[model samples]
Target: MKSSVIKIALILLGSYLIGCQQRPHADKLQNATTKKIIGYIAGWKGVDTSAVQAEKLTHVNYAFANVIDGMVTEGEGRFDQDKVNIQKLHSLKSRNPDLKILISIGGWTWSKGFSDAVLTDDSRKKFTDSAIAYLIRHDLDGLDFDWEYPGMQGDGNVFRAEDKENFVLMLKSVRQALDSLEKVTGKHYLNTIASAGFKSYLEVNDLGQAQQYLDFINIMTYDFVGPGTDTTAHHTNLFNPNLNGRSAAQAVFDHVEAGVPIEKLVMGMAFYGKSWKSVRPGNNGLYQPAVWNSTHPYRNIQGMVGQDGYVRYWDEDSKAPFLWNQSDSIFLSYEDPESIAAKAEFIKTHNLGGAMFWEYHEDSDDGELLNALFQSLRK
Candidate 1:
């Protein structure tokens, strides 16, 4: 009897460990063997309907992924539930039966809506319940909460100290609802979120409270600085690509130490670059205006080629790469195949949870960069 009890106990313990295997393992997930987690973000309402053309790849991140903030935030910022978005998502799932569609909520604009949603229980419920339905109807493989952050607010909203702990509670509620739905649907739903780039976001908000509950976290590793700044720097580099303190790789390390398990940390890759006017000594840094390109004077840096303007080509030293248009002498921010591939290799060599890119439309229609990512992962 004693022997049998010990055996059962050991098996139970093993299962629990597997459930909690998100940490330390990230450093060893890849070796001369095993597959790494490589995902992409398929966003941009302007993206082609067949965006998931790279479905053959192991995982698709579904970029600049937005959360259903409802019709209220729809005007200017309101998201329309067009049949096209739903059809495309389903098509991606059907094409690659094994493909994972993670609905990323919140982005450069979506975050503003979150500030108001979290303040009241009724409102939070309205958002949460609607979200649960969104996940179900959409048949998402998981949910990625890109809340920009709680306890702190940007875009006209004020941050409340209580939001620190409330973020965890919010995650807990989401997790429970997801798991419950899983029981009936007989499917395993994933739960991930995008973490703030700054350390203070975690410290003051105590993300440690929610870390354990999340299946993974994508650290927005880019945007250290851009056109709006008085200095230029690499937006996404494996290490000190531009010889700067802020690089995509460093952000990954920062989150790991913040109690966010390494396995649960997914590095955010920017497929786009930041641009500024003229390469003068005072011009550098990522500008917010890039996401809203229409209102900005800087044209699509990647789209213009053979043109006498913009800096094009990868900066091998920075490992990130960028382009500078000549005509307007405007600086554009973006990441190329070579740069993202290098970072993906870093992710593999370091044994990280693969990598994630910013959005879809930023990449060339040729899908050259996404092709590079698939090739790197295959090797």
Candidate 2:
């Protein structure tokens, strides 16, 4: 009887240990929270957004699902997309009740309203109020301010003195609103922003103040360089003195030094490739005519064109992707899955917030990039 009793006690102790090990850590996401952050972005949910596929990938924690129309300056809005996205998001609640679906407003092209809206309290109120309504309508868990920048323009924007202070104020106001809603609903909501790549990207902004409001910030780390009117180096890569600025590993360091909490920073990855063509073949210098091409059709040295009448191709040496052609000799650079995995590891090494991607479609459907990221960086 004594021996049997001792064995039972041991068994109970072992079970307790196992349970303790399973407990969530400070940084380790709760099963539900983890599922919400490991999200994907398809186009708009109103369209065929592969919502089912996303659900299949339900282990993903956060879904910054589509609802652009709702944030629009006019007309139907992302509200048109809200019902469908929310329904889809609701389906995931059964499996991941804590999973968060954020409405990411603004994009490479959709940032025009941001500058105008944030310039005044009334417009800011209009934008934020509409945003809250949209979130309420669709049952979203948070909002991602993806404004390209307060003052940046196409080649990417330079910072302004006003942007430094006003930006933090804007974030604080949004956070206050979200917190108010949280108080009433007892539902957790996230406040976040998507920033740019320059080492001094947010130089004009106050990260310390911003961090107080933001849950975290997603740094748009890719597209460091792209073809526009000229060949340029952009995107993450081993530095070559021969190339240009846009994309460089150093940019990551830049943000960290700027006082952004490394723990609250999620390195953004790119799954696509930028292409370019050499004006002087075999010279390995100068590319032109940038095209948005992903699958490199020819060898790294070779090139192809799309219906848009622009040629595209890749560069192997940089370990970065790009597009270029003879006419324009424009060089574009981007990141692929392999580089993305490396970035994920970088995030892990720094113990940063984790990782985020620009959009879901840019990734090759195998989930290789994000999966590798999950494996490398998951807490």
Candidate 3:
């Protein structure tokens, strides 16, 4: 009878252990299906690796690698530092094994070489070869092309009518190259792009064709209002009742209409705010005329809020937040925890892929905005 009791006890203990193991594995699988939170780390500013909360992020895009003379290379004079930064970013995997690190190539100033680089079959091949080589060298998980505008003169980039078609071709070439690499390594390499947020950019390129080659299309939904626009408005508002104005909702709708799958679209949030000075106080500075002021990181803006005569205001129609200094005639547009929470709800309701922010360092040292995003999205 004692021997029989021992056998039963062993079986019960074994079952308990197995159940414990399966629970965590099941939880992990569930987390995998949750929305992605992609953060763009500005390597140009030099990454403070220790500050990055890798657990909160699904992916980190290092901005940027540059295109020079039909080859993918490090930014001008940034090779040594970028290597170190990338290495540190790789080390972050110890904290979150599922984290992905990617190299973002081409930005507003570095995009000038794209037109010439992809102008011909041979040129496209060369660019593709260089991109793959760079990916291998850096031990990166993916590549993100931030080519600015494909067929337009972005920061005086060399553009042609052919860019509309060539843009798709370039993505196709990169996708094929990644597939080839996958065959040998048996590891999937992601291909993504930092797409422009406005309608004009979509009018020029065939994103429908482009999406087939991409894993995710991160729409730059911020910066609707910036320099050269002497107007005060929300730069990263989630909605705009005025159909003519720009908003995150409008951008997402346009992308769907442009043929990009809703499942693969990731909306962007700003960690920084746009400031305008010398503003007319009409309507509390919303949609009023003012001289464009310098941009401020959310951390700095946090200190200015409710201080220095800055009073925070919420726009119900747009589901955004702003700061107004009626005494000083200054206005600031930005994203806060409340606004980010609203965006998270929007993401869930729309069944969108996830949320992506322009940069990592702009948030508070304690990661207030990122925390809000992670909690809201994950919950």
* TM-score result, candidate 3: 0.91
Candidate 1: tens digits of C-alpha lDDT, residues 1-379: 9999999999999998986676434544434133334455454454355655646344555544343453122224324543345456667656667767766666656666665565566766676676687677666788777776677665455567877766777677778877888899889888778776766676777656688778877787877665356544555666673333676677777777777767677677766665555444223322222321211211254456446644465556568665555455455556666776787677776666666666555666676666776666545
Q: Candidates' TM-scores?
A: 0.75, 0.69, 0.91
Summarize candidate 2's per-residue lDDT along 124-233 as a digit string, tens digits. 66667776775786677778877666656632533355666667777877788888999999987888877887755566566767877888877777665554534434
Greater lDDT among 1 and 3 belongs to 3
What pairs collide in candidate 3?
A: none
lDDT of 1: 0.62
Query: What are the RMSDs of all candidates, in order?
Result: 8.0, 9.4, 9.4
122-159: candidate 3 lDDT, tens digit per residue = 99999999999999999999999999989999998899
Better of 2 and 3 by TM-score: 3
Consecutive 10-residue window with the lowest summed lDDT within model 2: 295-304
* C-alpha lDDT values of all predictions: 0.62, 0.56, 0.92
Candidate 2 segments whose C-alpha is farther than 4 A from its true place: 1-42, 45-78, 154-161, 232-234, 238-248, 282-334
TM-score of predicted model 1? 0.75
